[model samples]
Target chain A: MISEEEVKHIAKLARLGLTDKEVGKFQKELSSILDYFEKLKKIDVSDVEPSSRSFAAENVLRRDEIKEEQSKRNRKLLELAPETKDGYLKVKPIIKFS
Target chain B: MEIKELTIKQAHDGLKKKEFSAAELCKSYLDRISKKNREIFSFLEISEDLAMNQAKEVDEMISSKKEMPLLAGIPCGIKDNMLVEGLKCTAASKILKNYTAPYDATVTKKLKAQNALILGKTNLDEFAMGASTEHSAFGPTKNPNDLSRVPGGSSGGSAAAVAADLSIFALGSDTGGSIRQPSSFCGTVGLKPTYGAVSPYGLIAFASSLDQIGPITKTVEDCKMVFDAIKGKDELDSTSVELSKIAQAKYDLRNVRIGVPKEYFVKGIDPEVEKIIKSAIKKYEDNGVKIEEVSLPHTEYALPCYYIIAPSEASANLARYDGIKYGMSNAGSPASKLLDVYLSTREEGFGPEVRRRIMLGTYALSSGYYDAYYLKAQKVRTRVIDDFNKVFKKVDALFTPVSPILPFKIGEKIEDPLSMYLVDIYTVSVNLAGLPALSMPCGKAGKLPVGLQIIGKRFEEDKILEIGKLYEHF
Candidate 1:
């Protein structure tokens, strides 16, 4: 079962801004859903390996040689930014100092 | 009078014989969309200009007597999620409302190479999250079969478009029955090719591991044609594999072996749907195909396991939608702290179901719960895959219902998330196990349609498609 505080914590971790109504709604709803998940307790999965992917394929890697050609999607990618100045996207500074 | 309701084969034949110009075919579909889309709400955006231009080029190729591709000049609807260069690709979410694709998705590139005419972008559950199209940020797609009922979703619009003859075929991304369930409801054919048989480079990511882009078409032949045109490996999608070299063999319906999973015919399934599926299996049995009762013992665990794994991948895949990237951004908010930007933008941009999944996934993958939830789900996932592998060794394929019930009214299950999640029970296991599956209308429950699903081995879409074609005519 999920607690109200845990719901708030998960919402924050998910970067969602939940109103009081949403918080209350998700609090009740998420618990019921987790209750449904309680069915998983029946399986003895102690020795079973986790399947990270659906089917297996080797991860093919390319040689680490940088081709000097500029990406063709640069202009499009930059345009998708909320705020772009010339060729760069502006962002808030991290690690604020006193 | 109307050039509507033609299959892909017929459309191709007409173009080859010069019975109708590609422009005429394109115009007929665009005209149908203009008239019927007002009610069905199957499309979000119809690009008349682009479709006509593409049709004109096909006309030139036809006039020049060039070797024509199978789908050349054929008009189809694209699910709003897959990108088309210069066309709006919203994934039916408000976040990407004004965003136009900068490049074609691999499937889009394939469709373009054939000079196919794309009618428009179809509506969907926002980010392919919900079972019904009611979750679309725009609005729900009405079932053309019965306007009040929902066209099963998140590929509802694509299915409805094909069912209503708005397009010869449509493309839909199946992440946990998004494509198959909807096609079942709409009384059309939908195929989810093996996980990696088709390239995912351009189809917008939902749950990376389970999502596959496949066709929702009027007929099995069209589904096969569309699959052939779109499936192949690509450098852009690392998970994509070369289309398996299938041995050329005719799958005689009489010789095919089908496993009927007893777990699928459970109490929760609508009695009418169960009756239809039982009769379909009986028909297969009568027709000489070996029919055996099979136990997919872990199927009861599939729904919860999928709810865990899909959302976990979705949480990571969707992290890119933060205000700084290409989609909608509320960075201009009064609370301009970078964190506030992400919170505000996402909270405002995403629909309710999206937010719910994100929160659930964030919780599941969190530090302490990771081993208990996500890891356990994956382990169960291994069990699901093993179940299918063991069954396939005994039978060539499995037969089941696509959805457990008929298409309900739009608002019926939207309020009840668990009930809505239960809608995909019969289809989700295939996605979890990463196998190829197809959904076709078997019979009508009353006024609504019931779907028959045939699932095959990991890369054996051909075997299923061959048998599917036989059953389509049955």
Candidate 2:
């Protein structure tokens, strides 16, 4: 079962702040989801190759010609932003890694 | 012409007969949006000027002795994830709420080339992360059928927009059944084209390999029309393929072999859903189409494989939203380093479910768990595709229920992420297998709609469409 502490840990890794109530709630919910996944474990995939992409596409390449025109429109996009400072849109400071 | 309820084909015919102009059709849809969308919350931004201007150009072309394009005069609802030049393309998140795309997605350019009028971008779960649109920073989109219930999600607004007649058709990205599940709930036809059948350029990535843009419309024919206009090779989109230029299918279904996997009809599937799907399968039998019981034995493992693989990709894809260049910046915060800024911004910007997945994804991709989880899931994914390939050798298509249950009440599954994940059980396998699948309303369970899914071989969307159209008639 997914415990309250485990839920809180997952939330912390997710960088979310949750109350005791939310931790308890997600603990129960995530535990049930894990239980449900247990049903999938019953299936035998011993011989199956794990699939990431369903299509058979591989190593697709494009003409790497630098399209200088679209980059020129980048400034036009900044001009449309609701708020900007020092040529960049300004906002509240996010978390900084020490 | 009260062109609000007219099909794309009908609208095209009306434009040709001079009974109504493309501008007139655009105006009617705009008026309808003003009246209906207040309750539906389908469209995020309606471009009155862009739509009318394009409509006027299409009308002028008709008068100037030029041939009308297939989607000419048709107005479509675009999911907010797609970039539309000059429109604020927020993925329904506050982080990029005010951000506008400077250029169009390749699909958007193709639609513009066909003279289609874009109504507006519709709402979605923040960054297309959640199955229920409740994660959207804007607000939850109520199901069009019953406002008390959810319209089945991240693409809920797109499906609801078409269901509520706000637009003729909508384009939605399906990563693990976002488009098809919502279409099933909303009682519209939704298609998840084969991976790379349509270009993904300018589509804000949720999970790059899993994200596929497809059509949600009132009928299969409308879907085929829009698919033709949008599906083609684009130099800008590396994954896109030049799917058969023969856009329309001339093949008949009488000789096609159809499969119904006994495994998908497993226990816990709601009885009402099973009844509806079985009834749909019966229609093919009545048509001279051969039916066989095929086994996608690896079907049950799809959900666990998806949760691991999708979140792993999501964790990597969402790394670009650091507060440094774009989105919400937290520079002045007490946290001193660059990583703190990145974490705090994402913490504040993303909703709970998105965070949960990101964390789950980060865990799966972390050093210790990579082989145990991510690599293992990839191996299982290969098995799922192999299972499909084996089954397809016996049948042209596989029929199944879109979701095990009908649309739940609005708050029913919100507190339970597992329940929400369970909603995509039948759908996750299609994405895992990378096959084309369509969901059409087969019946109603009490008040909500029941969707019958037709799964076709990779790139054989025409067969799925033919079978889906037949089921619609059924």
Candidate 3:
């Protein structure tokens, strides 16, 4: 079972500001969740292939063609934005300038 | 006839006879939306004028004696997760609440090619994270059958809209039974096409590999039409497969085998669900199809494996929402750091369940637990797939309850994440095996609906569709 401290650490890593009440609530919830997952330990999945997709057809081929995206036609696309500057939208800058 | 109740086929025939102009039909749907969507909350935004204009174009094409598009003027609701050019694609999250899509998803492009009138985007659990639409930052969509009950989700809005006849059909993305369960709850036919049968180019990523775009309609025939229009290879999505070229199934039940896993019929399954399923099995027996009780001993492992794998993929797919690329930007940050912008943007943008899943996923994928959890889950996933393959060799298709229980009260399982996760138990294994599945309204448990699932071998959509259509007829 995962500890409350570990849950809190994960919450921080996930950038969530949880109330102590929420953290405590989630601790019990996550423990039960992990305990239920313990059922997987009993199953033997050897010799099985992990399918990445459901369709059997492979090499989904398309004619190689280059097409220009119509960037000029839809200026209304960005009109709903709360902020924009010089063809690029400006908001609180996301990346650290350092 | 009420415009919303008519099937796409019926609507197409109506257009051919010029009984009602496409604009008139669009107006009918709009009228219904204005009347009902306020309470149902099925639609986040409805483009009445835009839909009518598009419908007028379809009318013109019909009058010109031109070839009609398959879904011409058939109104469809797009789940908010899918990007429709110039429309809001918020995925029911505040983070991108007002975000307009820069481009259309390939599925949307295909639907548009058929001149399908897109009515509006439907709400969903934020980023399609939760089973119930309760996690939506916008607000929860109340089930049309019972206002106090939930429309199973994160595709709840789409299912509810279709169930209430708000739209003739709708598009929903299924990541761990989102499409199927909601379809079950809403009493609509929902098909989660073989993964990659439909392109995912414009669907805002939520567990990419498991995510599939499909139709929630009134019937399996409608599903077949929508599937035909949308299924194909697309250059935009490397994962989209060329399914049209695949061979159609030999449609006969005489030699076919249907696998009914014993694990699916065990405790915790509501008696009403079992009653409806037993009746469906009887129909298969009446059709002279063989039914053998099979074993998927690893059935219990599916929930854990799905949680681990889906969230792990979700963590990777959702990494794009870092405030800079797209969506709501965090302004007036308490901290001047870029990481702060990222954290606060996500924290504010995502709803509770989404945040919880992300944190759980991040921890599972963390260095210390990577091998012990994520890798171990992958190994188990392989086993689950093996179990299906071994069973499939003996059975032509598989059958299970779409969900273990009927749609619960709006707040029933929301507080309990495990209970919420348990709802997907029967549906997730199909995804794990990467096989096609269909959910058709078999019967109702009191006022709530139950879906009978038909699982097909990889790329055997035709077989599944045939069986689903047969069962639907019965």
Best by TM-score: 1
CA lDDT for candidate 2: 0.83
* Candidates 1 onward: DockQ, in order: 0.78, 0.37, 0.40
lDDT of each: 0.90, 0.83, 0.84
| TM-score, every prediction | 0.98, 0.91, 0.93
What CAPRI grade goes to candidate 3?
Answer: acceptable
Error of 3 at A86 (Å): 7.4
lDDT at residue A7 of model 3 (Cα atoms): 82
lDDT by residue (B1-474, candidate 3, tens digit) is 456588899999998888888888888888899999999999998877668878989989988989997799999899999988888888898888878887788988888889999999998998998888999898999899999999999899999999888999999988899999999999999999887788888898988768889999998999999988888888778887777677775656568889899999989999989999889888988978788999987888888999988988887777777776567877445667666777777767877787777877888888798766677788777778878889987888988999888889988998788899988989998877777899999888789888999998888887888888878666
Give per-residue CA lDDT, model 2, range B1-474, as digits (tens): 577667788878988999988888999999999998889898889998999999999999999969999898899999999999989898998778877788999889999999999999999998888777888889888898999899998899999999998999999999999999999999999999998789999999988878899999998999899888889788877888888653653565778788889888988798988988897788778877788888887777888889888988988887777665665666567777655776667767777777677767866676676776788888888888888888877777888899998787888887778778878889998888778899988888777898888898778887788788886675
* C-alpha lDDT of residue B185 in model 3: 92
Indicate the residue-level lDDT of B45 in model 2. Answer: 91
TM-score of chain A of each: 0.82, 0.67, 0.60
Model 3 residue A30 distance off true place after TM-score fit, in angstroms? 2.2
TM-score order, best first, reads 1, 3, 2
Please tell me which predicted candidate would have the highest DockQ against the true structure. 1
Off by over 4 Å in 1: A63-70, B244-253
